[model samples]
Target: MPDAENTLLLVDDRPDNLFVLRMVLAEYLPDCRLITANSAEEGLTLAGRQRFDGALIDMQMSRMDGIEMCRRLKQEAGTAIIPVILMTAHHAPADLRARGLEAGADDFIERPIDNVELVARIRTMLRIKHAEDRLRAGNSELERQVAKQTAMFREYWKAVENSRDPFAIIDRGHRYSLVNDAWLKLYAIERTEVLGRPVAEVHGDEYFDAQIRLSLDSCLTGESVQYEQSFSRNGERPQQLQARLMPIAGEGGGIDGVVITLRDVTREREIERMKDEFISIAAHELNTPLAVIQGYAELLRDEPWTAPYKRTQRQEFLSLILEKCARLQKIVDDLLDLSRVDSGWMLVLHKSRWRVRDELDRQVWQFQRETLKHRFEVACDLSCGEVSADRGKIGQVIENLLGNAVKYSPRGGLIRVQAEVEGNVLRVTVADQGIGMTPEQAGRAFEKFYRADTLDTAIGGLGLGLAISRSIIEAHGGWIWLESEVGKGTRAHFTLPLMPAGTEVAIPNEMSDLKIAGEEKP
Candidate 1:
């Protein structure tokens, strides 16, 4: 936008001199507004109320000389910056002009002030005023923008600092620009040692085993890099950490820096370890039944007509062979389920709201028919309202828990199953009066391929059922925990939120990562 209309203040006591000045300005500079102040009192009063672009005054006046008027204008801060030009008729000696300047006149003019010279001098003063005003305005705007940018940057870094993930930012020169608290904690590095230093120089041997320096250098070339590393400290298990570094772009779309982020993946690695153990144990367990089935089939085929293989005896042998084959198939099916759970391939139908009591009753009836040794009983709410959960997953959990209760109670004992409403939750507990576990064994019982060494030594299992059950229960936004004492009994309790039948629940991240890790396992 064009500058505000140029305004000038003219002060002179002589009415005749003022008239000449006003007439000259009006004729030569028609667009300029000349505000005439007949006396210093009038000029000072006018200046106090309004902002003028410039001022012009005569050197001689009554009551207040023009030099005195200029001095007064320069004294007060409000008017100090208004450019003052003095009109001097007595200019024979250079002292007069010097004295006028000393009194704060920007420039002195000799009378009879030439009409053109007077106009030219006034225009010069006006131009200087306009330039200074523009410079001041530009500086004020710049300061405001700087403050706004600073506030935005502060908020951005605050969010980075609060994140649980370790994160860092490096500048175009590869010097560290930002490092969050998590980053500092993960690396055990101090803030003083990192900021504004070259990333390579600062992290020279910190990640000695991994190619972290190379990864950072690759980011400067606009590459996104991710890899895993293990950090071991003082005899404790090494923590597996995954690091990813990506290029940060500048305003011109150039790679200016890098963003480095890392997250702990130790549990992920442990789960993978369990998966490997499952494959090895499954193969070994499946071989036992297969060998029995194969050896008997060969005997029946080779000695069909022998006297020792009488029809009745052959029939008995064939029956035993069929049982072994069935056992083999069952083992294969269970292993397949373990695989499905690990890879998240099992699609559990969350159908109509079904009563927990109905599910428990079915399991109880099956157990009653299957075995006469262990007694299975349910103590749950018969009319418990519907829950929003995957019915199949819940049933699977119950079946696994009940099966464990029976398997551990080899001497025949009572197994109690329960489900009830507690405030906004549906709580379930399964207790077995069996040879239980030590504290250390119970703590790891839910881990895949984990079992109590003593009790499970002669038992037939790959130890994946409890882990799979735990995974399913947790997927429904519920929790599962167990308490056991050596030679006593063990009770496992779980809780699910009580809500409307079809409430949506988000599956945990471990479940998703579990699937990916399982599929990638050997």
Candidate 2:
């Protein structure tokens, strides 16, 4: 009896022969299932309909012989692998046996068949067929696994290539095994020039020896290492880069290589520096006014009523206290405005018709009273008219510009204020012959917490003035900028669109429609 279930096909022209063959197979191999066909045509049809592990066919038939049937089965893709045994008559010709083998028969059997010999041949053929089937299945599974792994590798490479940060995979020999698109772009090199090349050769021996080699060695020793480095390319500004090195484990569970990733952190570092500077400056600015106010208030409190000129002294002390309080209020207001801007809150406008010349005159007159060293020149075209805008915000912007001009110019010179109506826009200019800024400083003058003057300079106030002024002007659908040259002078200019008469003003909530322009240099 067979160990596994088997299906076999039997074909003969005579019914008695088929009956005898079936009885013998059923008696010897009870585990096998046998299907009989009376003719070769019937056998071929049965083979087409289902699968058979092996087939036994009578060599002599009425129309189609066993040899011809065997050839046809071998020719078909579906039945080609089914082992065929041809049953020949006793004392069959040698040429006939040769022809049977040529027609793709697996083995032969004699007509005066010994029952045991017949059974043995069929069992052998079935076992071979079963082995071939298992091998074929194994090959198919291997192919599937290979295809799946290939797809996974492709997806991994695609993700690495599309990343913005630079990534590289180095082999155990310290040679470049893989580099993503960003890595190539960072070095401005080609893929062919990088792969299989030594790290020291590509990144320069000094750089590799000083910074990368030790870190890579540590990573290959199964330790993840991270470090920061600065690099300058093509005479450009140096970039602060943070590098992370991770160990790549091999099949044997040992560290094989290192995966390197680099991220640029220049802007983040600069922002941290600015934040630290702003905190220090804010503390000093707020402390100065508080000290002055405290001193004056104490003086007024301790003064005697009987002392001569006590009334005059008390009035002067009160005025000094009031002035310091005003200074404290301005600093608080500027800080509050900055918070509002950063939080994406709109600077609300109280829109009313107000003359540009009148606002300019008021700001100039106020500044002139505070300083006698600088002279003012005012020029306004008669055509310059009233604009619908927030009066307090506009006046604040004018004060900031005038204040900057006076503070920057220690050696006072002529300050000029001009106003004109250009088509539908009201243009205002404030030019000062003070110590100005370089092109780089002027360009970033409007940036929050950015000041041209260093901490050592005698200048005061937070750098929020220009930034807040820009926001206020932009909220009214206006543009503001500065033009300056180092050691010469600076000119500040701004334009506001004139609202048509009888038009309703719609204030924005997000300031999304504001058209803010960049700074300029002359």
Candidate 3:
């Protein structure tokens, strides 16, 4: 009579009692299966194995009385909620029937051996069993649906909290229901001050109403609004943020709430402003020097009057113009390199294999020619070993190091360059016996526009050489460093991975020809 078959546990001590009840109950409860136990212990064992829809027990038994057994069954969990019907003899008296009911029995049937009454009671219990089972099944189904929904909401909430950007959900009444940790952190506010309360009550009516009206209008129309805003908090710097507000829909396509996301853009906006300022300063520096050079050169050219006066005056003026031009060119180059590195457009190499000794020899020769008076030395433990690196980039790194060695050192100081293979990397060091830097100066030697203490303070250039050198070396998965004692000397050191012999290193595209032909004549 139910949607599924019901299992019944019948306990009795007498073999005759068990056999008669099984035959009678089998015909009456056709849809139910009967499990008969000879003793109360066996009945409990069966109940432990599987769930039973209902249980029946005889009043009198050899080992345990049915009333005590019923009490124990009710005490045991898993079987505690199952309905029980106690069967007894007609002569058992009204006090005994009251005793059975006191032992957690739902109902009792007197045993008169009346076939009709026994069948009728069994049917009545089966009907009650079906109704109880349906109620339990309904409760369990409802609980399962609730659990599934709760799990889904938990996962969505976790995602919102884990997101890097700020996010929140506001109900139709402009009340905050869900705000992730990032959203709270961004505002530097607490949940208790905002949640379950109208936005106007928490943040003020004017500000809250304006934002809510805009967001709700956009969201309900299935549109999204994105814009930037700035606000000051607790006397700190005004924080800038980019915000996006979108509508969240409920079941049946009705607008439920608005989802707002805010991303911090303060750092990005600051960097952009700094870039514009740098460009303005650089233009002023460049144009002023060029204008001076142009004015002096024109005066010397037009006033070439007396031969001796003209040659001497013109040459001295020409030298000054050339020197300033060289300084201006160096500034322009440094600016270009900075732009390339900052924009992430600089060259990067992968698995470049180079001949360390050959690369160092070429660099030494180039520097020797550039600084004709300065003596350069190259000492290599492994003259023919191969080193893995970007050939052009590493060469530029070496050139910057050696050039700095020549520039900072006295005209005749010793500049020694060396390279050797150590473990899986090739270590290169360029040591110059020149004026060295103090600990404070060495600390910021690789910083942009940084310069160390030198005997001559009139050196011409923005100090981006070492900074660019460090950037290039680090981009190749290597490190560059410098060691110096204030007055002793400075040694620049760097490393590159050593490849197996016979690997070819690719040249970088940033290298260009420095044509002395176009430069002013000496």
Candidate 4:
């Protein structure tokens, strides 16, 4: 006997029929087990006792036919997958094969089974069973993978919705497939309306659409793009927003869509603008005072004798030259202070207690002598005796306001300086009946180097006064604002705290350098 243990069953009612088939099978498969039973019930009972690799059942059995036995085996879940071959005599009805197949028979062998044909049929059915086993295992694995991926995607979507930053994913066709709460809120769009909608169409405006379209195309090509976009819609204040588009990978490692992120960066933009203005100041604004000093110095140095000027005239020329030099020095100091102030750092303060009145009086007296056109008034109720501040910086702020009052009141009207203690804060206001400012001008007045249009272009000062003033005040824990009417005048008001309760202020050194007396007059 050849060595093998694969079991095969044969069922037949006649002894000679079972013997003949057993001899033929043994010749071809000497090592395999071929069990034979005389009745359908006996074959079914054998099947219940052990597993069989294959079964060939005679179609016509005395008590139970091959179809009935095949049907019963197929109905049970445990044996339904076993391969069954129906064997029939030539006298069996022509339709017996078809009837056997319908009852779950896998194949048929004509009566007086050919050893060669029977062998071929048995091998074919075994191969089919093997293939079906592999297919069922593969299907199970595929289903598991699908369920795992579904769970991951559900968790990812929840995170996207809950995030604070604006997030969205658009497909290769640039349609919104996912959007976070921040995205919907920032765009003012409804979820039902935005999903599946084209991105450019939703943005609507030409400029924003153009920006987004370009980035979308780049992201689809697998490039990450980051940029700043300025937005101003309706009467809203202009905003600077930073945006990023990152490529999302898909099937076959190809770019599928983009995950977009946007955030507000207006304050950063302002700092950038100030840096640019600083460069402008160094490159160009320095020339104005240089030109003045050069002209007057040359006049006093070379042409004084030829002009036969009076004694007072010669002194005046020198004074003008000194003033211009001081103005140039002040420009340098203001730039340095601003660079420090705008940086996200401490505003290096030397706070000291002093009477607000004395500071304003000195600034007003100096302005009275400097300008002959504008009449200035000072009303200080020292009811708020001492305030804590960088005296030199505060003096510079007051000087700037008084200077602007005289400079823009080109028509020379009353410039009023008033200081009074309001609760814990002492309020100081400088009002000028000069050519004031438009609403837009006043709004940006405190920005670096922003000059109002109403002021004469010939006025000789860089536009750093209000910006520097605001930075100084805020650094000292105060705020400054300006109220202006187009043709009427501007009232620039600022407040400082009287020394905090129980804290003594150091006696401030009158560091009368450029931060104080030499600030650009508006």
TM-score leader? 2
Kindly report the root-mean-square deviation of model 1 from the true structure over all alpha carbons. 8.1
TM-score of 3: 0.57
Ranking by TM-score: 2, 1, 4, 3
What lDDT score goes with residue 372 in model 4?
Answer: 81
TM-score of 1: 0.62
Please report how far candidate 4 places residue 76 from its true position, in Å. Answer: 27
- Give candidate 4's root-mean-square deviation (CA, Å): 10.4
lDDT for position 321 in model 3: 95
Local distance difference test, each candidate? 0.78, 0.86, 0.76, 0.78
Write the residue-wise lDDT of candidate 3 on 252-299 in tens digits: 998888889898898788657545544555676688789979998788
What TM-scores do the predictions have? Answer: 0.62, 0.79, 0.57, 0.58
Candidate 4 TM-score versus the reference: 0.58
How many clashes in each candidate?
0, 0, 1, 0
Best-fitting candidate, scored by lDDT: 2
In angstroms, give how far residue 393 of model 4 lies from its true place.
3.1
Give the Cα error of residue 231 in candidate 2, in Å.
Answer: 2.0
The digit string of per-residue lDDT tens for model 1 on 97-163 reads 7777887889877888899998888788888888888898998898999898999888988888898
In model 4, which runs have C-alpha deviations exceeding 4 angstroms?
A: 1-166, 200-218, 225-243, 263-274, 300-314, 343-354, 386-390, 438-443, 449-460, 500-522
